[model samples]
Target: MWEQIRANKRNSILLLALMATVLALLGWFIGRAFSPDPAAGLFGIVIALFVWMILAMVSFAGGDAIFLAASKATPVTKDVHPQLFNVVEEMAIAAQLPMPKIYIINDPAPNAFATGRNPQKASVAITAGLLGRLNRDELQGVIAHEMSHILHRDILFVTVAGVMLGAIVLISEIFLRGMFFSSMSRRYSSRSRSSGGGQAQAIMLVVAIIAAILAPIMATLLYFALSRKREYLADAGAARLTRYPEGLASALEKLSQNTTPLSVANKVTAPMYIVNPLQKKGMKLSDLTSTHPPISERVRVLRGMAGASFADYSEAFRKTTKHSTPIPSSALKDEAVQIRSAGSQKSADSKKQIRDIGDIMQKTAGFHFVNCSCGLKMKVPPNYKAHQVKCPRCGKISAV
Candidate 1:
């Protein structure tokens, strides 16, 4: 997780540089198009930086709220929706996480999301359809998936990405307005036109206008790519926690098959839901550049891990994963309540749920001895006490 954070930090810095450069270039292109002032390019970069900082602060404090409000989700109580509350609570305990605040959207879509500045302040919201449709275990799997995200501390980047979408758009609009005051468009130099070289300036102004139009579209695509990556990570995390990948796999199938889109879904909040808010219409993966991984792709990975034990999941993750830090037993420690928040704030009757999940853990015996995705299985004695157990069949060691 620390490595993911460091990488994210690096990525954020690089993206900021890229955004600033893009904005500056557009500004320069525009300035050259018009009366040709070299200073205007610098002005665009400065404006973009100022807005990025302000947007970052807003995202830290209020971004989640804006998304929730946009989606018309209301904070939920146990009494209002016990199924959701129960499912979330049980999953939180299973994942060893604090109870995140619960919310329910009135919409009939089966989707959910986790958000907050940090885990302690985190909130998870679900749609009414999610409760009404999925069965207990499947719902548990779905919520567990969201809970995994909280544990991973992956919220800020997502929320910040969402905020940047809006900021870039606002910046784009401001660029367009610059045309009204420019004097380069006049044939005969209107009283307001400051044309030193009239017709050539008009062409530059036109090109600048086109760049303003295209800027938001490009930024939206970048945000889309981040969401896809985060979804993959979250899916993998869920499989690791439940040790039953099919739970989430089945849930994704249901979500993908369902055709009821969330009524309150807007461009801004589209990335918050488990599935795209627009999924009911069966859009192509190419059309989806938001919060969800391709449902098909996510399901494929989870089903592959269904028979996998925690150790099995970790090794696969480790192989292609750049970050080699072990999944601290602490991170996977009971109920995800500690070992940090796990810092996953969840939703419910904490003690009872935690105890129940612990009992389940103890009774749900037999971990993957090989813990490999290569279709190898090895069973150990019930009382096996090795720090690492190597699978005799595949010779893979699942460590203590």
Candidate 2:
């Protein structure tokens, strides 16, 4: 695990540096297009560095809040959802990490994710649909998977990478838009066309255009690469933490069968989810660009595990996928084994689970619940101002 963390750190640094270089080059070309002075390129580099720093600081400080808000997730208390809270607590303790703040997204997509700068500041957010669909062990599997992301520092790495990637895209967009709309750009082009070094300037312009177009794509590819690998590792960590590989395997199967697209998830936040929330249909070339490995493959690897150790997962991964380097050597452990095949457990009652989840979500969202004589529970929102409310199920009036 330490080796993997070190490797991720090194890779993150390299990736960020690569993004910075792209930004600097883009800035240099834009500056040179307007001014012939060599110092303009240096100025561009400085500007790029400043932008990167500012954005990085902002993302580090408040990205988690922004994500939660974007997803319409509300902070959840243990009292409102003791089962979810207990599962999170158990996973946190098993991973030997600080408890992450919990959130519940109101969406009905069966998905979950973890985010924050580090374990101390980490948070886990799951959709209401996930809570409704998954059984206790399945939920444990999902939570454990997210907790592994926190423990392994994948959240921090991904957050920093996302910030840098956003900066690159933002700068590139600014440059492209400026060139298209600014009169100064036209003047620069006219002047450069008339200069003695017109051919060189033309070449630089072409290079800049290509770089602007490709930088974001390249960054996204890198981000996806890192995301895919970290997911495999997180899965292994989850299996080790829960001592039940089948739990996660079964959860993956259930998630893959879910077809609902998450209303709040977008491209920027989709990769953070345990399962891709975008709900792509049919095999296409675009699947190659996905941030997650194929769900079926992940499930196969997990179900192939003969025990709950990292070594067992590693071996299973190799046999299942012919990938020999998914797990680091130092992280592998050989211990007592208890293996259960996928589908070994009985399915929970889905209607009951959905009702329980709805109640928990309503309570956490600050809705007042009143059970009427008609056996129907009425949920009044926090914004309701009336002192007395009439039951929708029964004509009985209830006092707030």
Candidate 3:
């Protein structure tokens, strides 16, 4: 996981550097297009660049915090919502980590997110509607999935991307608003800058101007794709950590079927949630360039993991969730991942390892409901069975 974080950091730096270069080149071209002399144009280029860098950094940092606040999420304690609190606690212990702080947004939108630079500092937030709507198991499923992200170190990308990507898009819009005027300004100011490579510089200037025009658009697209892919990665990681894939599956199903999108879910932080908070009910993830995998695909891959070996499930999930080429059986079968050296094997206990829903239902006596394909858990209830009789999640007719 540390290695993955390091690698992700490298990818982020490379992307940022790439963006900076394009912006610098645009400044250079803008100056050359207007300058009377090479030296003066270069000076203009440097000043323009200095301004862009300072603003970009501020915008990136400020945007992330502002977006989080805008989502109307407030940090909560065990007293706020004990059920969700306990669920996160159990998952934290299972993952062998400190408990994450919890937040609840007062919205009917069914979505949740984990954020912070690292696990030690992370916080998980869910919508009020999700709590009111889902039953015990389904809610655990969602918390488990979010905990998976906290365990896997995926929050860095989730948070940083929320900020920088937003800033870039905003920058693009600001740029576009000025582009036409700027282009005309360039034309009127085009008298001086002809130098040794006059024609060459002219063509380069045109290319740079066009690139400046498209850079934000490209950056927006890149951010969306990368953001969305990370969600799939987190999904697969969550599935790996919790072998009870059905939990997350049900959560996603419930979330997807709902239409109440969060009003606070703007472009910046929308991608961090378990499901896209954009309110689109029927659209698949592939149909849009948003930050989440389609709810349908997420649920599908988790359910498919039901009885498969961990190796088999991981490969299948990567293929299906991320739409990547199938991994070879030989590669996935590497015992290094699942099995360890002599006397040091990590037990396959990484899984929730529980298959009997009845056992779980029996343990949690609060408001229990159970359903069976064989129509057993759901039978005619006694007269007093009406109160705590049936399983609400499955809509099963209850007798127990």
Candidate 4:
């Protein structure tokens, strides 16, 4: 685990440096396109540095808040959903990390994700549908997976990479638009024609055009590669934490079988989800552009685990993918933990579970729950203004 963390840190630094270099080159090319002076490249580097710093600060400070808001997730308490809270708490204890703030998205898509700058500041958010659909063990599996992400510092790494990738996209967009609309192109063209540096100017122009077109794509591919690897690591972590690879394997099956796409997930936040929330119908050309490894393949690897250990998962991954080591050699423990099934503790009452989840979501959304004398529970929305409401079950008036 320690080795994995160190490798991730190194990879993150490399990714950032690569992104920075791309940004600097793009800026330099644009500067050269606009002016003949060599000092223009340095000025462009300054602008790139400024943009990176500002965006990095914003992403570190407020990116999680922005993500939660964009997903329409409401803060949830243990009092609102004891089961979900208990699962998250159990995982946090197993991982030996601080409990993350919990949130619930109202959407029915079975998806969940964790985000924050560090473990101390981390948070976990799941859709109400996930709570309703998954059994206790399955929910624990999902939470454990997320907790692994927090423990491994994947959240911070991914967050920073995402911000840098966005920066690259923004810079590329501006350079492309400027090239199309600004007088810089015409000025450069006239200067190249009049001066002896025509070939050099034309070469720079081609490089700038190529950079503008490919920089974002390169950044995206790097981000996706990192995202996929972290997911496999997290899965291994969850299996070891819970001592039950089947729990997560089954959960993945359930998630993949569901056809509904998450309405709140966009390209920016899609990689954070446990399963790819975006629905795809047919064969994908390559996994290079995907935010996650194929769900079927992940499930196969998990199902193949003979015992709950990093070594076990590593072997499974090798067999399933026929390439690349999933677990670092230093991180693999010799003694394997046996899988403990939680089937006996899993609830079988689907309707009751659904009702419980609905009640919790309503409470999280600030709705008032009223239990009537007729043995009926009614929820009043925040927008409701009536002081007295009649119970729909028994036609008895109740004062708010």
Best by TM-score: 4
lDDT tens readout by residue for model 2, 171-263? 889887876786566776775555575576667767766777887888788778778888899998899888888888888998888887889
lDDT of 4 at 331: 83
Model 3 scores a TM of 0.68
Error of 3 at 179 (Å): 4.0
lDDT-wise, the better of 1 and 2 is 2
lDDT of 1 by residue, 9-108 (tens): 5665666565556656665665565445767656655666677779889778787787777777788556455667887887788767788998776655
Model 2 weakest lDDT span, ten residues long? 337-346
Given candidate 2, what's the lDDT at residue 306?
83
Cα TM-score per model: 0.70, 0.88, 0.68, 0.90
Cα error, residue 59 of model 1, in Å, equals 2.9
Off by over 4 Å in 4: 183-197, 283-286, 345-361, 371-375, 383-400
- Candidate 2 yields a Cα-based lDDT of 0.81
Regions of model 3 farther than 4 Å from truth: 17-65, 181-209, 306-310, 318-322, 325-400
Ranking by TM-score: 4, 2, 1, 3
Off by over 4 Å in 1: 27-35, 177-195, 198-203, 287-291, 306-400
Per residue, candidate 3 scores C-alpha lDDT tens digits across 266-371 of: 7666667888788565665574466666677777776766442345456657656565622223324433223111222122221221222222222222323345
Q: What is the RMSD of candidate 1? A: 17.1
